[model samples]
Target: MGCLSEESPSRSMKPFVFTWNGALALIVKVSIQPCVTLFSHPKEMASSSSSSSSSSDIGVILNELTCPVCSELYKEPTALPCGHSFCRVCIEKSWENREEDTGYVCLNCREIFAQKPKLKKNVIVANLVENMKLKEGKVWLEVEVQDTEHGDVNVKEAMKSGGSESFCELCNGEAAKRCVPCDILCCEKHLKPHQQKGHKLVDPGVKIEELRCIEHGKPILLYCKDDESLMCVTCTGGEHQDHKIVGVEIAHAELKDVLAAKYPHVSQSMQSVASQLRQVQKEEEKTENSSRDAEDSLEEKGRLVCQFVNESVDLMKSEINKRKMEKLSLLGKQREKLEQQMEDLRQRKSTMDTALQDLEAISFLQDSKDLLKRLETMSDFKSVKRTPLPVLDFSKEENNLDGLIMLNKNFLEKIQKGPVEHPEKVAEGPVEHPEKVELDQNNLRRLYGRSPSLDPNSAHRRIKISRDLRTATRTGTENQYRKHPDRFDDFLQVVSRDCFSSGRHYWEVDVRSSRRWVIGICSNSMGRKGVESGLGGNPESWCLFKGNNEFTAHHNSRATDLSLPGDPKRFGFFLDCEVGELTCFGDSRVLHVFWGNSMDPVKPAIGVYDGSVHFVHLVK
Candidate 1:
């Protein structure tokens, strides 16, 4: 019985024990299952998580590291030996900033770098950075899940219940519906297309890598003209033959540098030229001012000289008037004295005529007495005695009367001549005639008798008014002062006192060394037939020979004589000779000839009023 009863309880305890062991085993299995599975896929899980986390960290780092120069994510980043990475432009700018220094210092590493840094390109790094940035901006869809009071709705079920939609972040295209099963947002058109066509989509967390030239792999731009090929140094010469290829960063940098370098020089040169132009303008202004001042000074001096000359002319006119008044007074006094002398001569002539008539009557009575004596002796004797008695006293009175008549006649003749020599001298002389009561018979007859009567017709008659005298009288007043003014008189006085009309009546001097010759004729017109007959009528006619040697005979007579020590050729006469000398110094192989009405050898005529003629011989 006991054995049977123990078996029954054991069976029931066994069911309970099995249930407890199963429960513990499930817990153990749940904990240890994870450990066992972790070992089996350890490398795979670690690799997946590390890659995802590294990618996320890398995206954050790249987003933070922007190029300072271009203010963008590094497109073509280059790594320096100092462990710092920068866009090519950022490094180049830092390098240029220290151009005056020995070297550049890295902004990140604080390391002194070479002045010419090795600007190596890291295309792989640049591409990775670009891919990370693209992944951050990838388009995605968002669907909101509605939770009910019962519980949170199933995302997949919600999408299946018309919650699925599509959205494009690039163009802001939003989904209007949701796919419950796919848990995607989609519009009406995209919903069908995404489900049916299974469109390829980029993961929002994935990044795109930056592309570089396939040939060079150095982040340079490929020139389209070069067949769209990338070029390294080798390709640059071969595949890129004549390509318009460029290192993108360097091309842009060079453009900026060129503009900066050239502008300043051009601006400085323009400023320098402008300053020089201003200086020149200032100098010109000063020079013009000086010229104006000089012109004004010259004008002032000219005016002063003109004023002085006008004042001098006025003084000369005043002096001339004073001299004219003095000359008129002297002429008036001389006219008065001449009239008185003429009256005195007329009174003496009348007395002489009366005395001559008395003598004639006495002579007639004596002739009658002789005739009557023969007829009647007694009557004739009485008449003859009466006439003799008158004659006896008639001789004394007749002699006195005859002397007075002769004296009166001579005084009258002197009065007829122009004005008497000196009125003062005549007034001082005795006016009364000499009283001779008993004149000698011979003296009385000599005084009364006339020497002879002048013949009315004479062979060599005196010229009443010759042509030369008439011409001199006609123009005398107008030309008198001009021909011999006080100035000319002074000049003549000096010349005449110092020089003589070289007695060489007609002489010519050949001053060849002085290129001149002087010929002259001296004349004195004091004789009966003077120099006026030989050398024209005036003394100045001799001056006609002053120029050249050509002579002409006109009116009365003409002659010419030329003498030379040597012969001459091609002779000509010059008519204008105002100044300077005439020379005959030329080749001596010629002759000058002349002929006139008179062939008489020129004789030297000498007189007090002689003039000279001169001839000038000019040398060739």
Candidate 2:
């Protein structure tokens, strides 16, 4: 850093010039020669600058750029929320040991991050070090720029009609020379102070006549940060009034800082998308390789089957050809089913591309959240099991045929044999199994997706249900929902179809956006007369309560806090009408079990307070 000269060159104030790189700063002590490159090995400088003074400077600079984890110059540095920087490899190694229950978190602060944050390369620090190596003759080449010189162009009185000349800025006298900092023309008299006042000595590049501002008719000295343009001091408080007015150095440093922060985040997002594309290609290649092995195994099995069939009916060759044709038809059907599934994914991706264009910042962020959830969700799958072909035994038929026997009895016995085994079909995405569920919850839910939808007639006046009937919100005004006996006028309550009466039932509510909400089961006899008929306020309703960061289970106006270690966004309710038991689950664990009368029709219900709540139907 060097000082800025003020008043006189002898009494200049030492204003240090600084540049920030990543989360650190590179503060150089002195200039280096043209041959010296900062990017050269640190050990190389140790011998050349063997003195104690130069050795200290080298150590400081190295420490600034090095990562704390590796204790060396950083490679792909990333900053954590705790303000600590580490090499991506070093940090990822630590993450590999984390337990699935706790999620990935900072080792120092124990602060949990949202899954895996993308690893970003710190470009500012890398560029700073790269430029430091490009030196030329005693000057670092990048910072200093040159301009064309227009010197000693004298201008006397105002321009004559026949001749071309210019007049001085101060008095209409002859313009002797131009001042670089103030960008003014002076007639040798007013030119002295503009230079003595530490005005930069730069090539004028243009004549005095054209350099003057068209509006102010003065030389431009400062720049307006708000407007992002250059202006003369006379216009500083005029058209550029109340703007962030600063000199060139201040403007340049401020603008660079903004870019440094913005560029890394944006670039990391783009890099992550490219990385995902490469990962998809790798997985596709692996699937193709696996298919090759399956093909080989199938070919060997088919050969054995053909051999057995050929020996069983050599005399009846027409029947053998028909059996082979049936096997080929089975394979064709499987291929057609797979082709249909592939087409669905292609259409989904094409629609997503068109929807992603021209979105504003708020819309983009919301869409990203939805996309992340979609990525985590398991894909829909329907298992197809094929009955194996009947195997014929010719031993019984031969005895009956007497060297010309019929194969009817033998084929009938084979068709009535033990159960056929079918190949298992794996879904294309992550799989989750509920061990406690009495049935196959995933597939059963899809089949019995019990229209657990919002009942428009049962909505409170202040409650608003989306057109899809899945989402409900507590709005500011009365939403003009029809007045009905089932509608709760006291609290913001909305009931479902009121159809669940017997057997087992399950459903989940998305409470991530709602800080305080009451969701549970409501019996047919639940109160709906007065304003006091909240979920927990009546005896007929059994509810799971959340308010002021507290969670509880309530029945008959009794409340019990659910002492779970963590809060989850989705809350699940599993009700067994036959046993008269209702279990509440959070995140995945059971929170409480409450006894309730289930002889009457029961419905899933919710009461929203702060924000909105959405219902997700589970048929199982």
Candidate 3:
């Protein structure tokens, strides 16, 4: 940290070199003089000794007093807390626009503080700068800055050294004047010869050699465009002979102007790029969080769906077990009855065996009448017959489960397709039926008439649909129909292909030939293979049944008798699905009405235990 001086004689002398910002240049000289310095001149560095060394020493002093900021000699030199020094004016200017809370920073060490510190002059550095300027002989401030491409350039500033004392370049004696063009130091006695050649002259210590070319020993007046170098007249005729050239001052000014104009835009582009980089980092974090959330949501839905399917399976298993237990109980009772009958027959055989053992004629004769009566009774006695095995019906449960599966499948598919454009238009399924309303008998056949055809696939083995598909007849022999899932297996019934969900319909049936008949509507979900599948035998069906000289309306095994003045062969049925009402008409009167709201997609059905019924088209 200490500068080299005559006082440090005991330490080995070496060059004190350091860097300034990015430019590496020699800053000190290895000498014992109080202000010793040296400059490397290619031509006369070793030749000039005593007086040249004295001048070089002054240059080193000037460099030591220079400030890092402004690249100028320090004016009012001030030292920071970190021991580095700068010009008071320059340091204050650097800190001017900075925020107070951000504190001040040292440009050299990049040290920060909580508040700006007060600045004061460093007396030691100031005294050295003033003393070097007041040296006895004329001195110049020789700041040699190195250029990577062109080598060293002398950035010399001339200053007075207290008096008019000067020295000639060749002789160590008093000098009176200087020649700017020839770079010669001359006394008054030798000044006339240079003046005769019209060379420009100036005061002693003036640095005219700075603008002169070192290689050619001539003033540098022009700049070479091709080589981008400074050139003298002699150099233009050498390697730069064919290159384009311009005045040095012109090129220097133009380059300065161009850089000044472009700096703002380049700086703005750099800041914008930094901001976009920050935004991209934030977006990356957000994307990671969203992906995790999506995974969690998917896992939750999968768990719920799996649970629903498991519950449905358990319910089905429970239903099967219940039906199986009921059938097993019935078989157990039948077995017990058969066992009792066998025991009674065994007891009678044992009594007859005992009586046969009596060999006495009187004893045998006395029991003969009673034994004959008992033998006759035994011959006439009838044992309990074995009942046919019961068939457990699961068709209705299967149909309901099938419907549920289809509903869920449709719902999942709908959601998977993406957002709905018109969510209000989506149907939620068949709605509950409304309150019942009466319909005029006159309009039953005219206003809302429909002609429903029988489905041959839904008919029982003994119930045959005619070729026209309008009539269903109960036959003694079974028909050769292909097996189908919807075919009736136990009941003599056939439903129409037509069905309704929400509307009104009217149809007529010609039942004159059928003494026992059933006609109405049944839910599409009703079981097809059970005794309960007969018309009006379960909650899924409603019908007007006629049998045993009685006309009745039946639903869920509950029948309501209806009295009519006379039996009319042609029966008209009016169904209002929205209100869940079915009205049967005979002889221009409402014969009976069936009401409920627990069914949907009801189709017209007909069952005949004897004879046949014709579906008549009443719509005009």
Candidate 4:
């Protein structure tokens, strides 16, 4: 208060006149006339002084005024025709609706100004407004002190300063308003806007609850079969509505129980089946091994059988060849003997013819008469002293015969001269010669002139049997003949019973019950005849049995016979049977038949002995 001061304009007031100094000065004189009355009166001057002082204070205030639009003190205050002093933003907003052609209208007077108005600085009014704001701050503080002392710290203070008016937080208003539920204070204009628009508040809280649809906002309530997932109600009604749906908690409980009950039995069944499969596989392996072994054994046996059969056939063929060689050797010896005999007969016949020719020539000579008279004069030819007449000396003829006989003896000696030795062994004792007996010449001549009956003993000499002939029997019948007196015409006649002939001969034997007979061609004459011998039990005896239906031959322990069903007419010399066939050599005069109940009729028996017959079975 003490610093306040004012200047008086009344004391200095004075009147003044203007005079024209030049043509331009005349306009200045007229311009000063309006200002003359303001300084004429003392009372008017005092009032002017007070107004001047106030104007000066307003200038100071305006210098401190901060505009709400630009936030600075006003330099050139443009007052609208409304007389309000404001910055351009505040004034423009207040008059912005006025038409451009009419220019801005005043907010205070609601006056429309037609011209664009120019603003000038108002220092006094600006200073007043600044001073008031400072004073309000000081007073507001003092009221806050009083409220604190009274224990009312929450209370709002009264306004004592000058500035822009207080505004609501929601709507920016000056009237008092507050929310009791949220415990927030605001202006009256903003209270309803806060409740309805700013805060998300609703009655019953139901609309607020539905706003948050996140999964964590609630527990899962449904199962989605498509994805097999647990989902909330919002997801179920939206994305999973058509899928198979169930309560999540119920599905979980049922699935857990089923898995727990069935696992153990299924595992056991799988293990058992695996074991059985293993057993079957092992058995199959064993069976394969056994089959292989059996095949190997069968192959081995077949090889052995083939080897045995081959060896047996070779041995039999060897035996047959040996027998054939022996027969051929015997035939060679017989032919040599016959040739020698023929040579001896031819020489004897030539000598006899030459002697008969000599006798005929002597009878024809009649010239020796004196020799004949001497023979006639002697009364006894034997007693006459006579010179011997040369009878054709037959003694010389006998000497020629004797020479031939000596040559024959020498040949026989050559044949018998070698050691009397068996082929396989040597005899220990000296070989004995059989006794030599002479035949009567008269009996020999009778025998030589005719076919003589056989004598057993003499025939035995001609038909010499070999010791190798294993079976032979001799009959007792023998007939003997006397040789005739003429030595050249001697023969023997002998009759004998049937006996086994020696050398090699083809023989067929037939047996009927205990009887045996033999039919064969002798090797010497190739004769065909049947000779009955005896039974076949003795080791050194054999026979041939001849019957109407059956024929058999026995030698050693072996017996051969025509089979019961054999053909009789076709079976003769050079016949052979082996296996199931019968064959004959030479003419087809031999036959064989086999009619067994168990045999094949067409196959019967095998026969191949035109030269030789062999039986063989070839096994592969």
- Per-candidate clash tally: 30, 3, 1, 50
Off by over 4 Å in 4: 1-260, 329-620
In model 3, residue pairs whose N, Cα or C atoms come closer than 3 Å (at least 3 residues apart or on different chains), thus clashing, are: 166-175
* TM-score, structure 4 vs. true: 0.21
**Candidate 2 overall lDDT versus native:** 0.58
Query: Could you give candidate 2's per-residue lDDT for residues 1-620 as a string of tens digits?
Result: 22222221211222112222321122331212222112222343244332112222232343345443333355566767655556677567556533445455653334678778766666655553354332332332211101112222211111122132344543445666655433344556645554444443333345643544567555454567678887654565476666666545445777889999899998998899889999999999999988998689769866974775566566555555676678778868977877776776666676568558837988888787777576445345455465675654445434423322122333244348733222112111111333343332332243233547898888888889998898889889988765588887778888997567765667778899899899998887777877447786666788888888888887666677677677789877767665466667776666776765545788889999878999975543
lDDT of 1 by residue, 52-166 (tens): 1111121123223443223345658887786556677656644543334336655443567555667787765564344333223432222222222214333223334532224
Candidate with better lDDT, 2 vs 3: 3
Ranking by TM-score: 2, 3, 1, 4
lDDT of 3 by residue, 1-620 (tens): 22434352211122332222232222332121222234445344344322233333333333355554433455688988877677887677556524334467765555776678778788777765544342353332244433222233332322222234376542333677776544456666556655643345678866666756789655565677678898664565578766765555556776788888998988998899989988898898888899889789769877986887788678888988998998899899988888877877786888789788999999999998988787677634466777787687877566555654654564466569864433124322111232232344444454467888999999999998888899998899999999999999988889999988876788999999999999988999999987788888898998888888788877788777777678789998878664555667787666665666754698999998999999997644
Worst 10 residues of 3 by lDDT: 24-33
Give candidate 1 regions above 4 Å deviation. 1-63, 68-71, 75-78, 87-296, 334-620
**Cα error of candidate 3 at position 42, Å:** 99
Writing each residue's lDDT as its tens digit, candidate 4 over 1-620 gives 11122341111222211122210100100011110111113444344433322111211222224332222344344555555555665455434422334445443233556765775556564443333332222221111111222232211222212112343222233635333222223454334433432222223212322433356343243456568876544465466656655544445665677777777878888889888889888888988988899689759865874775566557655755766676667666766666665666565556545444655545524423544454344443222233333333345334434543553454356458853233124211111321121222222222211111122232222122123221122223322323422111111111122222211112222111112223221112111122211123222222333444455544333456533344332222211111211122111222222111112111111111011111111111
- Lowest-sum lDDT 10-residue window in model 1: 27-36
Runs of candidate 3 with Cα error greater than 4 angstroms are: 1-438
Pick by TM-score: 1 or 3, better one: 3
